[model samples]
Structures are given as C-alpha cells and as structure tokens.
Target: MAKIKALKCKECGREYPVEPLHVCEFCFGPLEVEYDYDEIKKNISRDKIKKGPVSLWRYVDLLPVENPTVGLNAGFTPLVKAENLGKELGLNNLYIKDDSVNHPTLSFKDRVVAVALSKAKEFGFDTAACASTGNLANSVSALAASAGMNCYVFIPSNLETNKIIGSLVFNPVVVAVDGNYDDVNRLSSEVANEFGWAFVNINLRPFYSEGSKTLAFEVAEQLGWKTPDAVVAPLASGSLYTKIWKGFNEFKKVGILEENEKMPRMYGAQALGCSPIYKAFKEGRDWITPEKPDTIAKSIAIGNPADGPYAVKVTRESNGDMEVATNEEIIEGIKLLARTEGIFTETAGGTTIAVLKKFAEKGVFDKDEVVVAYITGNGYKTMEVLEGHLNKPIHIKPTLAEFKEKVVGQTINK
Candidate 1:
C-alpha cells in the first residue's frame, strides 16, 4: 500500500507522519489527514468505483485507508428523490439521503468508524474505543468486535437505554461517565494517553472524519455525478458538515466531474438547547461561545463542538444559513418527515428536517434548485421518547361499545 502523505494541523499547517495522534504539539490545533490527491486521482475512475462493493468502500481511494476493510456495511445509503416532500415544501427538486438505515448499527457513524478502524489496523493497534454521545460508541464497538479487537466505549451516563444497548450488544467495555458528553470527551482524551488503545474519535479522528466525505461523494454520484445546489444537515461536532464540503470540493479538484458554478449552499441545523454554532453564525462572532446542551437530540448535544468555528466559516463561505429549532419543533419535525416520507429519523435528523422546513417557509430554498438533506440516524434508538406522547386506545373492558366509539367511522379519534 502507498504511504499516506502525512498528517497536517488544520490551523498551523504543521505536518506529522501517520501516527496515533490528534492535536498539534505547537499550537494545540486539531490535526487532519493529508494525502497525495494526485496519486488518488490517477487511480480513481468511475468504472473502477462501479466494480467495488455497493458501500462507501467504493470510494476507498478518496478515504484515509489504503487497504479494503469489511466493517459494517457503511454508506451507499438511499438517496430518495423526495417528490412528495418537495411538493410539501413547495420545491421541485429535493432529496433525502436516508442514512437512518445504514448498515448493521443503523447510523451514519458506521461510515466513519469503518475507515478509522481500518487505519487502526494499519497502525497495528489492538483495542478500539471512542467517547460518544451515542451512535459513535455503537459503531466503534460493533466494528471493533468484528475485527477481533477489544473495545472500551465511553458515553454520557444518562444516555438513552436503546443507545446503550446498541453498543453493549457488541460486548464492549462500556463506561458510563458521570457527566455530559463534554465531560466524557475530556476523560477519553486522558484515558487514550494512559491506555494504548485506538480511540477512534480522539486518536483516529482525522481518518474517521474522512468517512463522512463519502456521504457527499455518494450524493453527488447518485445524482448522476453532479453536485447539488444546496445541502442541509445537522451540526454536532461539525465534522460531518466539514467533511461533506471537503468531499464535493475534492470531486471538483479531481476533475471527475466539473461544474464551475457556485459550490452548494451548506445549511446547518441545531436543536435550540445547544446552538452555539448557529448563534455565533447569526451574531457574526469570530469564535463560538459554548453552551450547556439540554435537548432530546442527545446525539447532537455537544456543548463545545470541536469544529464549531470551521462549521460557521464553511456555512458562511458557501453563502448558506444556520438555523436552530426548539425541542418541540424537533419532535414535530421528526413526526413530519416520518409521516411524509416514511423515514423514521432520530432527533438529529429532526433538527435537519426542521431547519429545511424553516428555510423553505422563509423562501430561502429555491424551488428549482437541487437540495439534499441528510438523515443520519434511525428513530429506533429514540423510540422510547415517543412513548406516552401519542396514546394507546383505552379499552372499555375490550367491549363492542368501545369499538363503536373508537374505531367506527372515527375522525381524529373522535
């Protein structure tokens, strides 16, 4: 396998050899994967990609890993043209990249972890780990177990039971940290140093984030190798948004497809409970002010998102908008997308759908423009939250009179 060019710090542009590291020693800025794109371009072709598996592995040349991996069947998520939802939003061309149904674990994080673990293997690491709000832990454990690697998963102590079970099913060493996700992250950074494990999000992040680029790649490829006019996605740590933008730009740089028109307008969504990025964007602040998250969208409840500043800059540079929705609005948005399109998304997806609705209502979304909205996780992880909100029928002792009142010619359960 060809060697990766090197790792480069995003802020200071300092370079390091491929290693189990994440931060720059000089400026303390985040480090990211750097590659010899010219080499990748020479080897990558549409026909070559077509012969690969129907997963994100098809874009392995563009990803961080040099070898093929058989992790979760990540990527190549459905790109359904939302004609019905488009009409509802008074738009002509809208698409939903429904990652809610992605592979074994059923979340977009599987895509990233696939590449991260592959890198971990290349680096000769044995143990796999992550500090997750929810989905990342689930992906890490499942992928690690499959690779015959021991795993340690850390998460917020108050996570949803379904999410906890999702990771535990893979039988990892799960730790419920006694605080919010931020607290869990700090602990993981420390633990990563003490324990020589491949913590995917902390140590293997530069490569991990490359997995998200596939979402953007697949979207463009599925749309006949063309870039969309706009994209809307939920922003947590902002990695997804940034990687997506990188994917599209990389496509242009490679000349695999070329359109000299405007780059897509990148919109970001956030639950109002933790919307420091959106607030910073709106207020025209240079740095994001962190906040304590308190929302049902626990997946995206990062108080101090690592990529917050980059997210704001990317959104603004693309002539896009960032919007936040209340928790009530998020629930309604979840129901709306599910009711309209049969896509049962978690709260993070709800945030995207809510933002899409908001922007559409405000006439920000052009009817003629091609738009793609990413739904990152399934609602199954959050189904418990829906219980008791919508009621079960109260039986009159299961009597015939109950049917007459409740089921017979009922309108709105009259």
Candidate 2:
C-alpha cells in the first residue's frame, strides 16, 4: 500500500489519524485528508498511472481509500472541442468537459460518491447515506446498492420528479423533509451523529471530495499534459472548485507534469435565487450565512456552502470573479447550448453557460486562450423546467397546401 497519513483541519490546522470523521474536535472546522507528498513523489509515475484502469482510479496514489471495494467507471470523460458554441461566443479556443454523461449515474456526483463509498467500506461501515439536493441522492442510492450497503437519503419534498425516482429506484430508504435542503441537511447531521451511518458528504467528506480532483487531472492530461487557461463550473458547496485546483497542483508536484508559470483561472457560477457566495464575494464579506434556497438550478442552490470562503479565496487569488445568472438567462443558456452543441444541460449547467457569457462579455476570457466549461448534469433530469416553453407542431390536413402555409415566412427557431 502507499504511504497512509493523517487528516488535517483546514481552519486551525489540527491533525488527526485517518478515520470516518469530518470535523476537527479542537477547532470545529472541516478536516481534509493529507498525505506525505515526498513519499508519493517517489512512487508515482506516468507508467504507474497508465497501467491503471481508464477511470479516476488512475490517480489512486493521491486518493483516500486504502482499498476500493466498489465503484463504477467514473471519470476520464471526454474533453470535447466546442467549435460551434465557441464560434457563437466568438472564442477561438473553447472546450467542454461534458460530465452530464458520466457513468453509473448521469451527473458528476458519481465521482464524489464513488470515493466516499470506497472510504466508507474501508472503514467497515454497513450503511451509506447523505443529505442531498438531487444528484448526490441518486449516486449514494445506486452506489450503496451496488456495494450491498443499506442506504438512507434525505432531501426536500420539492425535488424534481426524476431526481426522486432516480434514488428511489435503487431501493434506498428515502426521507423527504417538509422544508428546504438546509433544513433537511441540519436534521441529517444530527441523525448521522446519533445513528452513526456513513453520511458520504458529511462523515466521509474529507475523502469524498478528493474525487473532484480528477476533473482537473483529466483536463490537464487530455490537453496533452497542460492545464487550460481558464475553467468555469457551477458552485454548490464550493468543494469541487477547490479540489480541481488541488488536483492540478498535485500532478505538478509528483512530476507527472512540471510546474510552470501558467495556471488555470477558476470561475464560480451560481443562480440568482440562491447566490449567497456571489453576494458575499461582492460585499467583501469573510463569512457566509445560510439561506432558504429558491432557484431553477436546484442542484447548485446551496445557500450556506461549507467551502464558500475557500472558493472565494481561490477565485480571487486566481484573478477570477464570481457571477450569478438570472432564471431567464439560465433557461436561455440551456437552449443556447442545446442549439449549438447538441448538449441538453440542466439548470446548473445552464448557470455555467450563463455566467460564461456574462464574463466573456466583460473580457474575462481572451478569444485565443483555451477555455473549458463544465457541464455537470443532464437536462433530461429536470425536463419540467422547459415544459410548455415551445409551441406544439401544427397539425395540418392531409394536403400540401396547409403544410406550406404553416411553414411560409416562419423561419426556423434554430
């Protein structure tokens, strides 16, 4: 096995032995798994990674699990050149990491859930559970079923129909809170402590979030071992943004890629209805207050993001700005991407596209730089958001005259 180290607090810097714990007892802040980089550098190499499976397991040396008991073919997704969307946005070089088609489940949540469940099994946990908005529930339920662990998922009652069925299909015990996500999450934390279930994003969070680093790992490697000039992704708990940055730095530290003068700019996108992070960033606040989330992009509608400050720090430190898109703009973004790239993104992905446009218009991206936007979830999961927005095809009599009349002077919406 590789050199197993300890978990360290991100706030007060206290360290603890590796376990299924997420908070530092001394400081009450979040904990993250830490490794001896010097040891990792000595053992990991290009050939070592190349010999592994074609999934996120390729970077197993840096992950938290000592033994991965169960997982799917997660990560190593395609980095597609968005020639059509790029031309529409007037960018010469642009790409899309479309994890909307990610395996084992549709959304990118599979990455984090896979890591969390593997760690849960490593710790000998019998049940896996979480407090989720949508996609995480689906991932936890399905992964728990595959791993033969009893599963329990808590969520708000207002979640999309498909999101509800997605988890229920796995036969997990699904609990719906009458209130919003924050309410359910608060209750879940208390329940997790009381019942000792392996709440993936809570108790096993320190290890679970390491899965997101693969987003950066794959991007850099797919770009011929170089990082892009910029990356735009939706912000929920803010962990994803920070993990992606950490992944690239880890690769550079281990000699898989040499440290260079260039680094990718990280942009965080949020919906206007639940944009506490963006509001805090604009107001120069150091801390964030949790809110009752209300937005079309329910998947990215985290009000009191656990990693909000860290996300802002990374964005500002990288010379990037955070922005929020209106509900209308989010819908337009969904249509824009669908029309140009044939990718039907949900509201969270729409928030990314909408923010990309806002920043692009503000000169945040150079037309020649390699820019990549992450599409995290499929729109089919929330098709209700687009229902009745388009006109039904006109039923014409069995006559060519009626068909020509309906088509005449009516230019295609495309």
Candidate 2: clashing pairs of residues: none
Question: Distance (Å) between predicted and true CA of 160, model 2?
Answer: 0.6
TM-score of 2: 0.96
lDDT of 2 by residue, 298-372 (tens): 998888898999888888878788999999999999988998999989999999999988888888888999998
Work out candidate 2's RMSD over C-alphas.
1.8
lDDT of 1 by residue, 73-143 (tens): 78899999888889999989999999998886899999999999998999899999999999999999889
In candidate 1, which residue pairs clash? none
Give the Cα error of residue 358 in candidate 2, in Å: 0.9
Give the range where candidate 1 is weakest over 10 consecutive residues by summed lDDT.
388-397
lDDT of 2: 0.88
What's model 2's lDDT at 292? 78
